[model samples]
Target: MSTVGLWVIGAGGHAKVVLEACRAAALPVAGVFDDDPAAAGRDLLGFSVAGAVPPPVRWRAERKRGILAVGSNRAREALATRLAGVDWATVVHPSAVVAPDVVLGPGVFVAPRVVINPGAVIGAHVILNTGAIVEHDCRIGDFTHVAPGSVLTGNVTLGRRVLFGAGAVAIPGVSVADDTVCGAGAVLTADVSSAGIVVGVPARAPR
Candidate 1:
């Protein structure tokens, strides 16, 4: 296979992790871009900051294959839509366990110890963080983040940009709505409406 030139879209901590994973996977990292102009010309893991370029400009240039490293699902989803014409790479860490029948979309990241079971469909720019468990037949929408140690039970449907906080758990067949945020250690047992932030056991909206 030809060498892949990787252009990361963020410069924060998550971008650092993704850069390291890209290096470990032997992909050539072309550079990184951040919205903060001060972050430009800085170095991240020996890769120099390549200046801030909007998704449209970057995609139009087509300099390198892109990866959405932003942690905010809404931002990621918007960027993914804007850059739909660009080639985005899916990244799976070597230690992630993805079943043969699992379908992963472009720019998805499966971190180490992540488990994606059979028939799971993960959309573009989604992040399955470390040790996250995605059970069979689950449909994870674009740019959703399944945080470290979180669990999504079988047949769950997660809407775009939904964030499950660290160690959160969702029951089987539940549907989490778009832009919803499930707080750390929350247990979700029912459907969540769009744009809601739910926390605690049974996942009620925050007071």
Candidate 2:
């Protein structure tokens, strides 16, 4: 694999973690881009924040690859679409245990200590955050976030732009629909259908 540097798309806490994973994988970080004016020109992990995200033409011309480090699924997806044609890399931390047969799409970031079991298919720009456990045959759709310490049991199917919050657990074979947000530490015992917020034990939609 060639050693090409990347420009991380966020400069906040999530981006910090993603940068660590990138370093762990020995992928150089060229710089960072955040919309916040305060973050512009700041230094993160020895890499300078290079103002806002440049136009695709500018970054692509400079041979800058990118990975979305924003935590919001919708924002990540939107920026990814906007930056179409720019090169993106799939970054996995060395500490993570990814099964040989697990399929990962471009710009997917696997944080430290994540365990992805066999036959799992992680879609584009997904985040398998620190210590998350994805069990056998799981399918996570594009722009979804499996947050820190979350556990997905066997055959779980998560739809696009879903947010599985930190420490949450989905029981085996549960299917969560698109745009659903599972709250932190919530235990999902059944399938989630609607495209809104679900919280607490049993993980029902908010009334």
Candidate 3:
């Protein structure tokens, strides 16, 4: 925790946001990596691409904390699996308001202006995106993306890999299933027991 140098994985758009977060947190980045061969040797937001990602142990031994900045849930999970040996860092933007006791798992990204209330448990690699709000006592599952401007009311339970889309709203006490996609501007009013795409006000699968 003392050493602020990070080995950042991925060089895409998500990587850009995370790099900014690192800067805001005053965490110096040691290097940047990408799975795409074409991304190597290129520059990402003034940080030179340090070539393709090496095995976690290679970098971890250098005492730098790691972050998986890929956007896709599956890709992030796979990279995390590969980088299992890494000592992960939880990136919380300085502007985000998190309760003193909020439980944030390793590799979680709390973006700018995000509000996580008391008793919330954010799972590993979850993204609480810009301006999103998680009301008290919510439990967000691993790799879930609560997109910008979304709101999860108190006690909402999200399953793994759920995409709570931008500008969406989840009402209290609803349990969303794994791999569920709540479309932008949708309102989730009930439990989604089955994994699928839901949209429109009071979200449901399109008939």
Candidate 4:
């Protein structure tokens, strides 16, 4: 890693947690940048939020490290892809229990007390929120957010841009398609092959 500190992109609630995780991991955070001009000069965890992010070329030339801290999967993916060549920083909270063989992709966030068992494959820019448990061999796709207290049993597969909501659980061997939204506290007992919101104890689209 470069001696220079990393920059956090976004100044929302999720950014707060990301900043804390970075601090807990002892990573120097340069500052936070948000597109919202109003966010500039506001205090975020004692750091000032800059009005604008550095240009993509500047990030490349300066070799700046950055992480996307937004909660929305689509927005996170957009911001990440836009900043081509920026060295994406992977952040894992100090308390996270990630297995030695877990394959974590660039810009992944493993939050406090999260457990990723061995052979799990986490894709780029994924967010494993606080206390989430990903059992062995689970495959998580890019920009997916396994929200706080969620659980994925062994061999569960999630597609890109999926939002496994807070406290949701997926039974073993289930697959969720891209862009699907698993509602908070929902349970997936089978496959979700469509992109839409699923809710209830055994999750299904509300129709």
RMSD of 4: 1.2
Candidate 1 lDDT over residue span 128-150, tens digit each: 99899999999999889999999
lDDT of each residue in 1-207, candidate 4, tens digit only: 343888999999999999999999999998799998889988999999978988888776666798999999999898887886778989999999999999999999999999999999999999999999999999999999999999999999999999999999999999999999999999999999989999998899997
145, model 2: CA deviation in Å?
0.7
Please write out the lDDT profile of model 2 over residues 1-207, one tens digit for every residue. 443588899988999999988888988887789988999888888888988888899876788788999998999988998999878889999999999999999999999999999999999999999999999999999999999999999999999999999999999999999999999999999899878899999788768
**At residue 183, what lDDT does model 1 achieve?**
98
Q: How high a TM-score does candidate 1 get?
A: 0.92
Please give the TM-score that candidate 3 achieves against the real structure: 0.96
Task: Write the number of the candidate with greater TM-score, choosing between 1 and 4.
Answer: 4
Query: Ranking by lDDT, best first?
Result: 4, 2, 3, 1
The segments of candidate 2 whose C-alpha lies over 4 angstroms from its true place after superposition are: 1-3
Error of 1 at 100 (Å): 0.9
- lDDT tens digits, residues 1-207, model 3? 255578899899989999999999988889999878899888888998888888866765577788889888889888888788788899989999999999999999989999999999999999888999999999999988999999999999999999999999999999999999999999999999999999999899989
Local accuracy by lDDT, each model: 0.87, 0.92, 0.91, 0.93
Order candidates by TM-score, high to low.
4, 3, 2, 1
Error of 3 at 45 (Å): 1.5
| Clash list (residue pairs), candidate 2 | none
Residue pairs of candidate 4 with colliding backbone atoms? none
